[model samples]
Target: MIKKFLVFSALLCSAVFCNAQNAQLEAAVGKLTRLMVTPDSLGLDSILLDNLSYGHSNGGLQSKPQFMRSLLTGASDFVEIDLTDKQVVIQNKIALVRHTLSAKTNDKNIPGKVKLYILLVWSNEKTGWKLLARQAVKVPEK
Candidate 1:
């Protein structure tokens, strides 16, 4: 009876650990989306690497500082960010998140919607999970 109880406890612990990891990934993505919507460049400065690479849906690469500057200068105003069909996978301290991103822009008198499939890599930091990299591709029209 003692052995059975021990086994059950181990299983329960494993389940809770898995759920906690899932919550961490979800929170990371949520914070990132919030930063984008608010155009909070300074807030992102601490969450992304100094030399982070951004894979734009328009087939361009944006460096970390460049990306931040754009948002701060109002060059890119994210009107809305919607995440859908999100899947989070974690291995050790690394996590991969895939989701459909629907965003609207209020840029230079141009207003339009852009839909893309995004893959984000996150790393667990001493502070929390920080976005390590991001790659986005324009969603193909059906």
Candidate 2:
């Protein structure tokens, strides 16, 4: 009886821990999207790793500095964003996040809408969870 009880307790603890980790990762993802739409340099910098690989749907890849510059200069202006079907998987200090992103943009004063499958890699450090890498692929129109 005691063995079974201990086993149940362990399982329960693990489940709770997993839920908590997911919540944290989700919150971090939400913050990232919000910052993208608003273009908060300091806020975005706080959550991004120093060496970030940011890949776009156009087969273009950017470093952290380049990404920041584009966002700050209204070159990649995201007017609104919506994320759906988000999934987060964590292993040790790293996490893989996947979601469908639909956004309205005004890039270089050109209005557009985009739907993308986004994959974000996050690394948990002493400070908290930070974005390590991100890649986006264009989703086919229906």
Candidate 3:
């Protein structure tokens, strides 16, 4: 029937839309990682929401300005960052992403490595996807 055909088409369209949104979110995350490692101030400012809440495993939290300052001032220097096992779910204008982050950093010139489970919340804006929040928990060594 026409009704059934219409229903099928609607479902197919929704699935395709979701796939495209997921790809966009993944690309946003990738760009964020690159910007973090390289400390691109302009790129960072564009990609992060003004009210960003960035939480670390040590129970520390930073606002958007603080986070940007840390990167700009060499307080947080990432030599390399690798993200794995990423899963992204999109709901309306928000996307939730979970991933494993393994990174080498030089914080205040003290070199260190970290492995953490990260959760990132992105808000889809008119310009693009902006990082709204992020939390990281240390992953135990196996």
Candidate 4:
């Protein structure tokens, strides 16, 4: 009976820990979307790892420096960003985040709308949760 109780208690504690972690991760994802729309170099730099791999739906890829440069220079301009259908999974110190990105953009002064499926990888580092990688693919239309 004592053994069973201990096992149950451990499981309960784990569940609560997982829920807390999920909430923190969700907030981090939201922060990322906001920074994407309104480029904040410091805020972004803090959340991204030095070797970030950012991939666009067009098969374009950017390293951390390249990504930061584009956002800072308004080259990869984002007028508005909306994310929906978000899901997050955590394993050890790594997290996999999936969501639908619906955004209105003015890239190179040309207005455009994009709906894409996005996958983001985050690692829980010494500072906090930092984005390690991201990939985007176009969402199919009906």
Candidate 2 — which residues are off by over 4 angstroms? none
Output the better candidate (1/4) by lDDT.
Answer: 4
- For candidate 2, lDDT tens digit of each residue in 1-142? 9999999999999999888888888889989998898877898889999999999999999998899889989999999999999887899999999999999999999999999999999999888889999999999878
Off by over 4 Å in 4: none
Better of 1 and 4 by TM-score: 4
Top candidate by lDDT = 3
Candidate 4 lDDT over residue span 5-64, tens digit each: 999999999999988888888888878888888888898898899999999999999999
Per-residue alpha-carbon lDDT of candidate 3 for residues 13-122, written as tens digits (9 for 90 to 100):
99998888888888899899998898878999999999999999999999999999999898989999999998888889999999999999999999999999999999
When 2 and 3 are scored with lDDT, the better candidate is 3
- Write down the lDDT of every candidate, Cα atoms only: 0.86, 0.93, 0.94, 0.91
Candidate 4 CA-lDDT value: 0.91
Model 4 per-residue lDDT at 57:
93
Worst 10 residues of 1 by lDDT: 37-46
TM-score for each candidate, following the candidate numbering: 0.90, 0.93, 0.94, 0.93
Q: By TM-score, who's the top model here? A: 3
lDDT of 1 by residue, 6-118 (tens): 99999999999989888977887898898887867667987886667888878888888888887777787789999999988899888999999999988765898899999
Q: Comparing candidate 1 with candidate 3, which one achieves the higher lDDT?
A: 3
